[model samples]
Target: MDLIGAYSDDGAPSPSRSGDGTAALAVVSAAPEVRCGTCHARHFPLSSCISNGIYASSQVDASGYALVESKLVSQEDTKFFQGANTRMIRYNLPADQMHAPVQGPTHPSGRKADGGLSNHRTGHVEDSHLSSYAFDEQYNSFHSDGVAMDPSRPVAISLGPGVGAPPTQPQQKRQRTQQSKVAPAPVDLTQPFTLRTRQPWAEKAAFPEQELTEEHRAYLEKEEKAEKDAGSGKGETSIFHGKALEDYQGRSWLEAPRDLRDDSATSFLPKKHLHTWSGHTKGVNAIRFFPSTGHLLLSAGLDGKVKMWDVHNQRKCLRTYLGHTKGVRDAWFSNDGRKFVTTGYDKVIRLWDSETGAVLGKYGEGKMAYTVRFHPDDDKQNMLMAGMADKKILQMDTDTGDVVQSYDYHLGAVNTVTFIDEGRRFVSTSDDKTIRVWEFGIPVQIKYIADPAMHAISAVSVTPNKKWWCGQSMDNKIVTYSATDRVKPNTKKTFAGHNVAGYACEVSFSPDSRYVTSGDGEGKLFMWDWKTKKIARTIKAHEGVCIGSAWHPLETSRVATCGWDGLIKYWD
Candidate 1:
């Protein structure tokens, strides 16, 4: 089965087919005609066609179909096929082959035309002019006429220099039409797809009934009332309305400054002052006041030194405790003010006698300890919770220095830990972008707060009165949460407007729970109106990262902050 040539209306082969078969060529026609030699079938209206002398002439039918055939030719064979060439040739004698001659008169009926086949040059069919209909017959077999085509014995036409060798087998063409890939039906995006054999499950678990008791409800109401009253003066401009406070970019605190500060007092005394007693060569990480006398302050620093300070005098290091092998990350005083605990990068928490600076006990083995805080109301029986760089929380018994429980709740290092209301519950924040509340007996998560900004929560503190809790984030915002039942638990209020990236290292509330104070990465101390969610006062508190802050337990007018600058600043 070989392709001789495509027939032209003028009975000549295309000029472009004269060169080597590999030369790129295009065939143009309104509707090219095709014939099959096998069945003497003719097909018409070819969409696209390529010619190769080695392959059979095949064309698409009216419905866009084509047939391809292949034959094994031997070098010894002379004639192309064993049969006579009559079947592959077409005669011009048939009226169907020609339209009326443009200007010629018809021959007299039954009489032979004067120009016989021998005398005619272009008008009559000669051996050279015979149309190869038999060759066209083999090309038409590729069509199916709206019927399924045989997959096993399919056909393809080979073009170019490789023509007439053998046609490639038809392949399953990729379904490129968009309609062919559509499903039988459309799916609804809003509906959950459920398998019939499976049971439906709740997406989120409900809060336990015990958590919403009458006592809890009453507390929430009281807290809510207090918060509302504090923000009521600003009406719709209030920022504490949602589960988390969002930035109101165009609105500046300066536009509403009076609403954030109390100008009633004539003295410049703050509600509390943090006296930094500096002896470490590096930044202080934690601070605690003596439980018996609020005048004594204890601080731990990255320089691996712990210092006790006398708040009454100029901020000076009164005593230094050296034991930890690495930087001290956290420090806390026992309830009786006679002892303190310090945790550090050395992976140990050491209990120390407050008066003599004696190492009482050592707990924690190989984990990098981040923070340590004592239970609020107990001296002998204290809860020491420490944050670990290994993404875990450890609760230890202060008396025995033994780990009581370990929590693997955070995905990243736990940065801060603080107890809520007498160590009955506690809150922890982490670089994993979540804050969690843990109750004493329950192992499961009680409340979880996620920040959409995904910033690490660097520090968390619960107010002394237990009315509110505040967390500082790496996103330069201070978030406040209400602890009382008068308001919704876990709701956050964000205070923005820090010129530099704020790493809220410490946060505390005034005794009245009216003002919130935070230390930033730049050693700036910002006091925010808890109710208004606006910055009340800004103090140049330190020269570097202000890592720790504490309020004067008795003096409600002063606060202190320690920083990387190896200095602690007192604000009033």
Candidate 2:
């Protein structure tokens, strides 16, 4: 008998007990429960089903299929039901009993509908009517053996139509077993092994004799001709015949380019002994070569002495000019090769007649004259520019030693001053971390290279062609700036090698403009290839800080370096 009842988690209003003294499975009457299509089962607790808008069935029909009522099932489940082939169906109850719309069951709307109960008579099941309570029912039939079976279950019958029993599951298949055999140990093919009866290595057949083909005979003839020609000195010239002996003999004396060595291998060999010259009693702060005479060099020392030397002859002190009371910091010769100028800590700039070793004039009254230079081309109206420790650059007339104009923009000490050409346009580097371009004829400042990180530009030198300007910073970095575009100067490269952070006290470009040389705080002199921006060579030029370096004006590969060690080195 079909029984309908409600089940709840609280156990209220339990189902009726059957004759077998067991309660029947609850079928919620107030609200239906939703069933899974594949499992054909519904969730219990009709209160939750009512809240969820689903219902369960009390009895199964002839089709052994049931409906689950709910509008709350997801839209994906709706599509699943529409395309499903399983023996499961969904139903919609009367509108007044449903909380949501009756979207399934496909019943006609209004009075024109002719299926199920009429909506007008029962006041229910109308598409336009809203629902407040609704339910669905699930169905399952019992097999003849009294076990429940799903209508969707597939059955295979063996006998007569409608009367035969269904086939049972087949027995499990058995697994095959493999037999194990003992394998012989591997044979040593390199040695000999007798397999069956006779030893194959002990018996051998004779090789047949064969005649050479025409092609093979021709190859042999060609080889004999080549051998004869080689012996007679007519075959392709031997690569090892003539210069090989000389090349082998010179191998021990030749020096290879550093880059030719493997980067991972040792490329540098330390010198066993160092060569030193100490004619100057005090720190030699500046040194420069005579433009036309490469063998002559000029040096300025802290003793207020400017000495000329024959650098090629064991560094013999040639001439000494003493006038300044303080240390002589810089010295440079004129382009005409007639005179040179020296600036000192006494704040005096002295012009000297080089041939007579005589002092000519003294200019500027400021103390701490750090650097001095003459105009590149003009001899009569020679311009002497000097930077002071008080952050001012004084331009003077070399002929009279009279101050002409002053650049007063640097906030700190002006360390170096350099001219680009003979056009009165020059550049200066200061302790303020700024390099400025100033035109002599104009009153306005032309350009300013301000980089906060580029601190203490101690020395500045411009290439002869004015393509680049290079300088050394107190941060132990060599910086090069492109002068190709004046409006926006760009730093082309930076070279770093010094161990201590301080200015490169002096710097100069080689006469060919192919190399640049600079002296740094650890008494090291460095040569850099201008084009590659790489350090080409380095030497410990002094025992103390090397404060000055200069290239011979006329000798492309010759250079001079001086330092606090009171020593000067001439390199070629």
Candidate 3:
């Protein structure tokens, strides 16, 4: 079975034997002659010879058939076995010992007759050359990091009189010029790298002056005239569309609870869901309670609308104010609760009469306002400040609608502005990971707080006693800082549990300052004990990131939360 198509010189089927009298296997092919050791046969594909598990050399008869020996003597040849008792021969050949077949009249040395294994195209080879690399006993060198020793350069083995190692060619040295040592100029971080020259988000004319048609120009001019003269109420109106204005006129439906009037009462955690207000067409960004009274709730929405909800009565949106043309980022109520300010991505800060739903004044310097706050002092209610995307704290006079002063120090967009120390000074946070304190009406910064491990503070709230302030850090924690002159962070009071990363969720303090509550990116309301720094409760509050929560200023357990799902919830 080991032989295939073995034939004699007459072309009849017959097996053959080698000179050593061992049985041989033969194969027949029409290819040219091939020789290996003492065996010679016409060449066939190497795959056919090795298919039977034997790579034995073959001897060819005159009729072009190969007789392969059964017992191979060369250890480099392959052998076939049939049973457990059968003998096996194996070859272990190094890669370099293997040679490809030479085509034209190759000799036993595997060299062609004409080229003799030294052809220019095929490369020179000698019979004794089994490997490509040779070893040298006396000369060996290699390159390291520095200069390598050149073997071509001669060296003396012994130093005799007037004789030494040959000198190496001198290497050229690189010449370096000394840098100037003049003192560096001082840098003032209080100023921006360059003055702002243009505002891309600033409001512009409907069309360029040169391109405006007469009708379009006239209509725009008339609208502008009306808006300026207060004829259009600055594009704001009290018309409630389908609802009666009388319901909101005197806020008659709202009745402040008796217990809410006691300012000294301690706060309690809200345990039950009270109500949900679903009016915003997009995500709700921030929410606020009426100052002192907490009778009404205000919310700013990504839909570019501000809504006022009656807290004590209908628990519905009492009035909606439409002013900003883009998403509203923040909203704040004045000390008396009669006025409120709103800032938005439209690059405008708006002041509105809460009762009348009329926009009183609009102010902007072509920079997006991220947050706004009214002066806490009663007499300074007309003055307000805004944190701008341009990295500045802008103090504006609501009555005049003009920016009176700018506190410019932050290297990033300002996110929050809170007045502490009884309205004499204010603290601001920025994306630059800094908290800055400034004296009111002053253009200089009073204190600059920054740290290598600090995160950006998105929102901030001062405790009722004005003793501590907490910031909603983007790191998913509420970090506390002193409200005193030193303005140092209170590291021992970090409240962490819920995730708020990538969101500007606002944190709030309970009315009595015994607890802190914040909304998280997971739409859960998280409250932490002020003294223990442990979570009091976690309530599933919304369907999306709960961006802000507000504890009632007067009530012990009332809380309001708003989220990106476009709904606001009341919990008690």
Q: What C-alpha RMSD separates each model from the true structure?
A: 24.3, 29.9, 20.9
**Model 1 segments more than 4 A misplaced:** 1-278, 313-316, 451-454, 485-492, 499-504
lDDT of 2 by residue, 1-572 (tens): 33433334575544444332123333333455555433366643332333334433333333433344533454323433443355653543333433332354444554333333444765544444423431111111123422332322333323334444422333112111111133334454455444622235332222234799999999899767744542333421111111222245464111221233122211222222223456678998777766655556777888877876654444566566766656777888887556888887666677777755555676765466788877766533487778888888887886566678888888898888777645457788888888888886454578987865667777777776677777777777777776554634556677667653664476677666777777777888777777687888888777888777776554345566778878876665
The best candidate in terms of lDDT: 3
lDDT, residue 569, model 2? 66
The lowest-lDDT stretch of 10 consecutive residues in candidate 3 is 171-180
- Structural similarity to truth (TM-score) of each candidate: 0.54, 0.50, 0.59
Q: Give the residue spans of candidate 2 off by over 4 A.
A: 1-277, 312-315, 484-488, 553-555
Q: Count the clashes in each prediction.
A: 39, 15, 0
lDDT of each: 0.61, 0.61, 0.73
Error of 3 at 363 (Å): 0.5
Task: Please provide, for model 1 over 1-572, each residue's C-alpha lDDT reduced to its tens digit, 9 standing for 90 to 100.
Answer: 01334444576544234554322222323345567543345533231233433233463343332222243444322232234334653322322122333235656673344334333545554343424673343444323222222222243443434344322344223443444465424333355663322135432222123558899899889766644532332111111111222236654211222223332322233644444455678877777766534566677888777877656544455567766656877787766776778887666777877655566677776677778777676542467777888988887886776778888878898888877755677788888888788886566667887747657777777766677777776777776667653223344577777633545477776656677777776767777776687788887777877666666665566677788888766666
Q: Pick by TM-score: which candidate is best?
A: 3
